[model samples]
Target: MVLVGWGEQVFRAGLKGRGCGVDEGLRELAAPFVVPDPSGVAIRTRLKQLTAVDEEVLRRVGAHLGTLASGDLKARCHDGLAHDAEAWATRKRELTPLSSARWAGAITRATHEQWALARRCALAHLQSLQAGVHALRHRLSLPLGQKGSKRAPGGYRSRREWHAKARRLRVLEDRLARERAAWQAGRVHVVRGGKRLARMRHQLPAAQLTELQWRARWEAARWFLRADGESGKRYGNETIRIGPDGEVSIRLPAPLAGLANAPHGRYVLTGRVRFAHRGTEWADRVAVNRAIAYRIHHDPVRGRWYVTASWQTPASPAVPLAAALGHGVIGVDTNADHLATWRLDVHGNPTGNPRRFPYDLSGTTGHRDAQLRHALTRLLHWARTCGVRAIAVEDLDFTAEKTREKHGGRKQFRRLVSGLPTGRLRARLTSMADAMGLTVVAVDPAYTSKWGAQHWQKPLTSKNRRITRHDAASIAIGRRAQGHPLRRRTTPPRAHRSDVHGHRIVQAGGDAPGREGPRRRLPGPRTRSVPPDAERTRATRTPTTVRGVRGEQEWVPDSLLLTD
Candidate 1:
């Protein structure tokens, strides 16, 4: 626990101070304050534990600081170049996690499997800021034309060009507005200062260094006890002893050896676990199995202790797309609140009744998880009933798309984006569907909603039923997966008579036949023998002429004249 205490103190101090990274903080401040290690914990392990805590704080703070910078720059850009440049210069030194300390601390202490997570977050945010700067600069560089009360003769583009420039300016204006909003709201913070940690404590059970280390131990409990290339002796091995009454004892690693001698040794470092159906197989392979890894964990919610064992399993055979499509497919439309699904035959025709399974995500983590589980269960059950071996869904990603919404997008749209359960739903569906012997097919999401609404909506809707845009989208998604054309076939319209003599026209409408306009009759076949002989003698042919209105007239030739 000494490492935890020291780490927490150092982290708090680092946040208060201006300089020093994780390594510098450790060497300059925390390394000097080492306490007694009576438990035989190595210096290396202690340092690692401390580093993990500090790294977490840095990662979270860095991410927010980058966002803070971007927001400031955007706001400044809106006012003027001078203001934008000034703010950009100042943000490098001024941004910090101090503004929202409780939220910052809570986020920094969130559970992460790796220390590199913080660096990744910081880098990602920085890159995003750079991209925004480039885009904004490019937009600002365009020839937007002069703005004035009166138009100048040659100073502006045509109406079309002017409208396009106006559109670009409006887009830039909206982006800046979003940035300002993001800054005002402190984009990354979960909640405000007072009573925040108290509220999040349950969600974050292992925020402290000691608790974190314990959690790590449980996670890493499964380790392969093997030999070196030459010595054939295992490192980090535990001496396991079994009693006559099926009791078990274990001598743990150096850091945990003191726990082995503690009063709660059995509960802390060792405990008995039943093997169940694989008991005999495990017993037989105790000394024979090349790989021997075991893990033990406690489910805080269930109040139960369980042991886990791992073994390599063979890979499942790959199912070809063509083969899977032979059995028909289930088209799924993932939405913010529910999954919309429909079954389609091999020919892309809807075969069964559509289903909608709703789920609530605006709840506790456990509650959301339970809701998702129930939804997936029902969807899969229905899929099984339909006897479709393959399911088609949109390959979607919203992170980058939604990132700017928190600052620049509409409030309703932003809320909808935030509440979308796309990622988690996709992951859960894939694994569960696999376990139930079904194939998951991902298709392009482009124009599915538009095409679906345009073609499928009215057809799917009826006197007794109303089809939603998403339901139509689901059908579109399935059809796209099966490589079918989005447009439906229609019978050709009948031909219509035209104003031109002896000619017909193909009309698009189903209107009744009627005189569109006055028609002109063609002249009878011409007699040319005498006229040709006279024209040959003249050595030239006269051109045709037409009469004018108001009794005006023009000359005409026999072979090239109009008849009255």
Candidate 2:
């Protein structure tokens, strides 16, 4: 039997033959690669100290532009597979009279982006449905109560489960067919205010919100106050512009142009926006007339307005893997509730004690994001203090693993896997680490936990220092990123008890002599009762046999008695 440790649980899997070992049937692992630096940077600053008139003007402008955006999105969706550049230009032309040419351009661009995102989501949904149908079909084909192997799930444990699964299979099949048809026809379902928030309208009590608050949030979410940047334009953007002096201004739509307080149909808010983070970069970009997009939005819960500035940066050259790992790395294992981390040396040996940065993933989206960011901040600080150049993490994707038909009754496991912030962690870490000049390396997630538990867990654990499976898995991740095998060293075969076939791989250098020899004897007695020289003394002891006597010789006592 082979024991596999998944998260905190260890499960036993039977091997087909006694000759097989824990390493048998393991999937090939992918090579570790450095996560490239983020190609875009976004900075947010609060828009404060606005007068009542300014707020009214801003609201009217945002609403007007938002209506235009909504109409454009609807038109784009209607075009679907038939959409072309000509159709896109025509939509922009229709909006230009209502909004300015720049505002129309931004709205049309946003519409195209939203439509593309919806298509991508539809494709993903179709793939997920296909996976579910395949899993359900595979399981339903087997006999009821049949056992399964490591690679695939078994039959249902009962007739009731079998019948339910059969029904679910039909449902999935129908959904899959519909999704496939929609994908082919380029039809996508998208909600202006997120689908989740839209549903909360019917469940206001459960959402802990009153009708007014929900309406406010919903409208705020659907508002399109974002404007794309254009090079060689005034202050890098013509629609929504923030001057180098931190003055916020917006080019109003035709209907709201009458509300403009500034020259040239632009409204300048009394509030100044200062981006404490990356302020210098934003100022520099504005001075150079580089393209920088800006967005203005209101948070209903906070009762505040904020402006976000974003711009794309050129992709940095890919650093060689060796250079990235030259100063070693901190391998991080992302869990549902915490991040498990451990530092390793250049040789892939773990250094110091393991550390865990805990964070709560339950609560509102903003709360969860804040918790995750806080945890990651602590982790990055620790890594920086250790002087490591890179952070290693598993490239985990639990998309297919979250299917109900795949895990069956293991609802807890499914939820656990689903709750893991694999994608978010990678994105956040890569972006954060890039600013700090630290590389993020992603390694294949296969067998890291299982092999780490088998090899490094207990050996690193002691009364003073307790190492969990996640900590051990961090070590495995670091080693894999450093191009080392997960196992510390390979053991010799039982018959040889030495490296007779070849030298043991992974731990020692090939140039080391006597690598296969028995361990050197220590300078003390092996046990309390045995002296240090006992073996030597035993070897020199005399033999009791008479060397000159034949095989059947009689006893010499008879001759001795006659002489007496």
Candidate 3:
């Protein structure tokens, strides 16, 4: 517990406060890494008295945190882009330099992605502005007309009328001219900034520009990054430098560096083997061998430390989704609190009764997550039992559409939308399904409900039991993913219907001269004689089921028979 608390303090200080690095000449600030002894006395040892194993742990923690911080920086840059887009489009405002203080500390330790993230956002914003200017100019260039102007009394019959008409046109023309000038000026300024950036690139080395000058140039010329190609993105040793023998190190900012007490004012950190297990231990093999990076995580409830090492490996070839979709697909219709599921064969025929797995989310986050995990476990087990290879799910996203204002601006609607477990469930499902070797296919959710209810309810139902609307929808989702038609022949054949109604009657038979029946036979060709009522109308346009040419042998309903 003491070691855990000490590690936590060091991690928090480095990530939230002045960031730490892995180098020599360690900073010697009052020792926040100091852990209290069993006697409750604070022990100050500059963290050097700790075993080499513990020191390595601290270093890995710091480096791992720095990488995660880069994610934060990327998010901030993207958010800035979104805010700028809204202001420009809705408020007619132009782009401006972001607050330097907000990004001051982050810029110093920016990763390759962080730099690219900012540059791309700035370029996109400038391009949007240019597009707006072009649209405005096109609107202004239309031939002058009295279409939108109020008609003058007497209509140019007198000097006063003519004067009034001319005056209105002039006023409108002047307003347009002013707008054009403002837009053109903004364009000129942005272009000029791009030229300046180009000049700097020629004058300075890449490293020099990368370190201190790029951010300045980006701010001065809002879209200067357009000149550079993303293929040149730097990673690996450039961003995260690791020495020979797996000695990882990073350069800390001044404030964080001063917190350690190593000689030469540098703080160096490394990876150490904690416990070995048949030469397959985490620190022995995982951390030191082919470790592209590491991630640190803490479980507050367990009070333990965990480091996940990422390794670079050759990509494994995966079977194509079509080939892997072996027997059939399991369609999962995700609702607010339950997953409605059904299975469909390759021919789009429902294989079994649908299932509903209910999960409760009325407690803490951990409790809700547990409930979801249990539900998914059961679902995947069922899929495995049925020998299903692919799971079809509706590609439903409510982030942008499920808004309070859209639902009558009610507070309850807003809360409900916020509480939806779509994101977590989708992520968990994808990961777990992949591990189980099940391919997940996302299908369009358009009209699944209406179409399913209209076409499938009666056919998929029995006299004693009927499938719910959601279960029918699940069937639709699976068929769509497999490229099968949704609607199918549902009504029984005319003869079958007659039999069911207990009103069957033989039709008056017609034996044509060339037809083949007990009474008539043709010499050249023979055809089966049909009753007058049984004979199908050749000109009747009712659609009937036709087999598709695909390997799945889909049943395509006759379009003429099916209503929209």
| 224-343: candidate 3 lDDT, tens digit per residue | 101110112221322232333334333333334444444433344444322221223223333343323333333323333343333333444655657655688887777657788899
Error of 2 at 460 (Å): 1.6
Give the winner by lDDT: 1 or 2: 2
Q: Give per-residue CA lDDT, model 2, range 203-321, as digits (tens).
A: 99898999999999998998889999999998999989899988988888888878888999989999888999999999999999999999999998888999999999998899999
- CA lDDT scores, all candidates in order: 0.49, 0.82, 0.49
Per residue, candidate 1 scores C-alpha lDDT tens digits across 176-273 of: 56655655443422222213433444555554435554443333222211111111212111233322222333333322223344343321223344
Q: Measured by C-alpha RMSD in angstroms, how accurate is candidate 2?
A: 11.9
TM-score of every candidate relative to the true structure: 0.48, 0.83, 0.45
Query: Which predicted model would earn the best lDDT?
Result: 2
Model 2 error, position 500 (Å): 14
**Which 10 successive residues of model 2 have the least lDDT summed?**
10-19
